[model samples]
Target: MTSYVPEYLKAKNRKTVFDLFLRDPELSRAEIVQRTRMSFPTASKAVDFLISRGIVTEIGSEEPVGRPGRRRRSLRFNPSAYAALALNFEGRVLEVGLVDLAGQLLQYEQHAFDCFHQTENYAQLAPMLQAVVEKSPCHVLGVGIGMPADIDNNAETVALYYDRQEVVVPLKDLFGDLLQALQLQAFYGNDVNLACLGEASLRGGAGEKMNLCYLTLGTGFGAGIMNNGAIWLGGHGRAGEIGNTHLGAFDLKGPLQTQIEPLETRINLQALEKAFGINLLDDTVLPQDTQDQMVEFLLPALVTAVYNFSFLFDMDQFVMSGAIPNRLPGLAACTEREVNRLLAYRKRSVTISRPVSAHCTLIGAANAVFEGTILSELQG
Candidate 1:
């Protein structure tokens, strides 16, 4: 006969066991009990519950170290039990990926758009998303959309595209019917914010507790802020708009005609390319003089942003990513030197590094779905 367990206790035990499997990949019932310090009966019940829910699976067994008479059955977190569809909208390209619960990308495809003539063609997203969901290897949990737009997370609406062209898109309204048809929930977030989450996922425990900022230097500039493993969306979910922060005045024509420019105008890929007259996308190495000039123009603004972010959040690290920073070698080291120089008063220097993976935004979108749906389901 099976003993009854309270629903709350069961949920808590399930989370504990699930977290262990996530960290260790595989564990036996004995190991789960030993690591989580739960009674054997409780651990068995939790594992049984997880197996029933298809979250954990019993695979082949391992023999005990001393007895070596019988094998102990191993339980593994079944990453293939569920999948998520991730979409990243980067100016003219829409990248779609099907990712497993383990944050592994199973399939990917890119769709291009003519921004000038085909701005309204974003409606194609539904069929594309539906096709990917149908092709998922497991039960599709939900969809996560990351775009370069000011998102009102509460309403799931795109307040503005910042590119100065696309219309105000109510993303939930555009995708609501599709979500209903597929019977899956939808999540919306800024592309950079999702990228930060992706980067954080790569770090695991180190990232979980650290205050991190993911700054992207591309056609435009933006940042994703993470506070103690959670994405820190401000009062309106617009907290990481570092690109819009105004720097001091500059003499555009002369001292008489000074002008104020945001960080984007002076430090982004477009500005760097225009300043150096070199096409970064062409994959040619920047001339030393060009690199020096680009660094000179960017270092000050970057230092200022880092300085402000450091004081505001007591940030532990800054991750530099996106097109310009990724392509430009030595950018992170250069920026780090500049920031360290400016922050001489601090006892310890801030850590700055590049992303581990190029497809960070796509991975982050999938991660959002996993955390929101799977983790919530486990806890709920």
Candidate 2:
């Protein structure tokens, strides 16, 4: 029983046509109709609308088929027609990026927030956004912020975010000026959730009907969930907060001293450092086979997370990201294998993949504003 949504609500066909241009360098009208399974005229109408908005442009024509018949014009997604101001907030670092429609980061600037040298993050933020917006070559769509915090999607605000020193940062209140000063809208998303969105855009699959989860294993264990090309923030916006789940049973020669701790507190970099009695992720120290030891250590937490996400969200695709997991290539395969063993009775398929680019969070922030503003306008 698949519930149907109105075309105007989702703009299913229009977005499908537009997404093809982003994935492919150029496309023909006939090709769009063929790939999207839309009627010829329907494809043409969407293309015409995009062209009228300067979002899509007719560059030239394709090679004539057979006997040099009438050449069909080639259409391309015009990235310069609009751009988004993307901001990614880590504990101490703030990454400000100017991203075009094709997810290209045209310009990027990094700023330290709330540090001793930069105690005034709010003061530096407005200027940073203004500087990025001033240098854009096209119309600025809006601002997108990706932070490690709970985002209230309905209210369009970051509910809670803390700095490295555990100082509270009211993300929504801080952005009031940057957006208003620049006369732009703002979209807030969880950092990992935005990463998933960035990956989905890069994959450029069939429009809508997309379900994905991105597992992060850097300083902490977390996940980003995506459904229908949007971050599935769930009620109250804590959809993928897997860190606080208590440890589940698994085989390990030596477990952490505080085994009763939450899964995230147990598997994070700090936890591993304390568990292994050294900096497990020290700079320039790529452990030899000891990396395998690290994987074996976190295997229980990783397996449990995948199983929970697969069963709760019922998604078959999971992507593993962050410094530690990405460094260990076998981590994903091992986790997928264990999770499948758990789901063998159900006969369900689950796969764990790795990241294609390191800049997913930045690109995903840009994509948020693009979908909410530009795509909506195009649909209308």
Candidate 3:
């Protein structure tokens, strides 16, 4: 059975319409009505609302055919209407970008912080956001943030978070303040999930109704699960903290290690250095294939991790993406091989998938802003 779009999503169709205008700025009402398959009254109401919000405008007009020529106006998204801020805090720096409703990047900034511990991240971030907000165009909507953390909107904490040094930060608190201070709404999401959201929007995955799990491998590992086009934020808004699961346990030195070894301990950058018996960061003698070997070991483990998660969660398929652009294809291939290997053991088959295009959590962070900004305009 084909599930109908939910009422909330139907109400949010203004976003879908505006997104179309952003794509093709000269679409006629008849074209939009045909594309959206919406009743004329519904389409007119939504389009008029967008026009009133200054998000859409009548670009020009087309003459009606035959007897009495009537000018029918064509609609276009006003490129100058509003803007959004997108930031991704992963790896080397805190990346910031200014994007318009049409997804055009206006400005971008990055501040590299050698130390990203929880104690000082907000101290570092608040000013950066202030600077971006001040420097950005006045029409900017709000900010959207992507972080390597498990965000609990209700509790306002980072349940499981990572920084450059595998440190923790109060993501929700810092985000809440930046949002309030800048007087902008914000969303704090796991980086992997944001990448998934972005891929679902800009990439070929758009308009498809399917369950998706976005797996990210970089300095850290995480997954974003979307079921039937809706984010399944668990009770604590940490549904996809798959990196915390243990692939295998070994007795290491300490109380926390004794508790249980996390998969992060087995596959993160720190683990790769330990596994290779060399310093990948500082050592120049590291072979060219050093990164490849790390992927060979970790990709299989990650594949099993996904298999485990899928079995438990009943997800149909997944995609792998993140900062490691050069490595995604290999990771996808390895994951496919590993999944096939597992199928032999289970005596059953399952589907595995990849994103339609190269992905950046930064891009998705931008989309989060666009989606939210549209929703806000609709409400107001």
Candidate 4:
């Protein structure tokens, strides 16, 4: 007799099968069953569903070199079935990329604004985006936007700092017409959060249950938390806004007592440049003494931030990115040493490292869009 399976279980099994297929170039039904520990019938059903939906394809049988007679039919993920568009909005630059279902970049472009005022009209770049979408090699699944700011509750607006002023731009309203015309789903998220996702993707999607934090030390300071393979957008989607957290004592009697200086004010690239009189972005190399001095000045605040985050979230690993860390060679090791000194008494330790790729934010935006659209649909 056939066993009765609930719809939720079927959906979960489909997702598992699909995820496995994505991880591996090819898989057989028997292999899927062996890997997932699912019944052969369930695995077969999921494979059949995926094949029917054009998400997967069955190639010819393959025989292992060692095993002579054991020929298994191979199934491969169909990369051409869907595509995603990723847009990363930094302070004054916008980077766009087209990615396939398998997270391969098909095309990429970057646009830099001459001034802050030019970014007010988000729709100004719509024509360029539309041209890319029309030329996509496959069906466009969705668009993902990674903003260098906090997105509001409605997912319709983002609050970004530009020219020493905070501006709220209507995200959905800006892209509404373009998305409607393409009939594509759109997702907006913090750029750092997407960078964390991109870093996780570099690990081949193996950091699902791990508590990973992506700390960015750039023009402004922020962090992205990834727990159990998902972006941990805490209550109100502002979990990684560590820039606003105060690190020093407050003045009880002063009018600005409640408005203590935030951690970002002391450790960002601007602060470093102000303190050392050296532009971090410039190609001119600094003397050993200057580099050491800069490291000494930046290390304490970074260590303090790491300690606070590790203590609060019990982080397993910290991935450092952004303008400063990428520019300074040894920043990661120095930060790690400081964190080690601070957490020496504790039984647990958190690891610190740098990003695997320079295009982490852009790749992450694409991955987020693909996962949010394709994986979400499968799981749902």
Specify the highest-TM-score model's number: 4
* Cα lDDT tens digits for candidate 4, 1-380: 22545765676567677667667868887788898889988899888888876889988898865766777889988977877888887766888888776666888899994323423555567788889999998877788878777786465676656776887767665566657665667887888998888887766662336468998988888999987767888765788988888887767778785567888988888898888887888888778788778888888888898999998887869998888876777888998988887788986677899888777787787777766665545432
* Per-residue lDDT over 194-298 for candidate 2, one digit per residue giving the tens place of the 0 to 100 score: 999888887873257788888898788888888766677777788888886775654466665445567787677787677776564556565667677878888
The ten-residue window of minimal lDDT in model 4 covers 113-122
Give the alpha carbon lDDT tens digit for every residue of 239-278 in model 3.
8878778776555665664677667666566666677765
Global lDDT scores for all candidate models = 0.76, 0.78, 0.67, 0.78
lDDT value, candidate 4, whole model: 0.78
The reply for model 2, stretches above 4 Å from the true place, is 1-10, 62-71, 115-121, 161-172, 247-260, 326-329, 341-347, 378-380
Cα shift from native, residue 344, model 4 (Å): 3.1
Question: If both were scored by lDDT, which would come out higher, candidate 1 or candidate 3?
Answer: 1
Clashes of each: 0, 0, 0, 2
TM-score result, candidate 1: 0.81
Badly placed stretches (over 4 Å) of model 3 are 1-10, 19-26, 62-73, 114-118, 121-128, 160-181, 204-210, 247-259, 278-292, 309-317, 323-329, 337-359, 378-380
Better model by lDDT, 3 or 4? 4
RMSD to the hidden true structure, all candidates? 5.7, 4.8, 5.5, 4.2
Candidate 1 lDDT score relative to the true structure: 0.76
| Clash pairs (backbone) in predicted model 3 | none
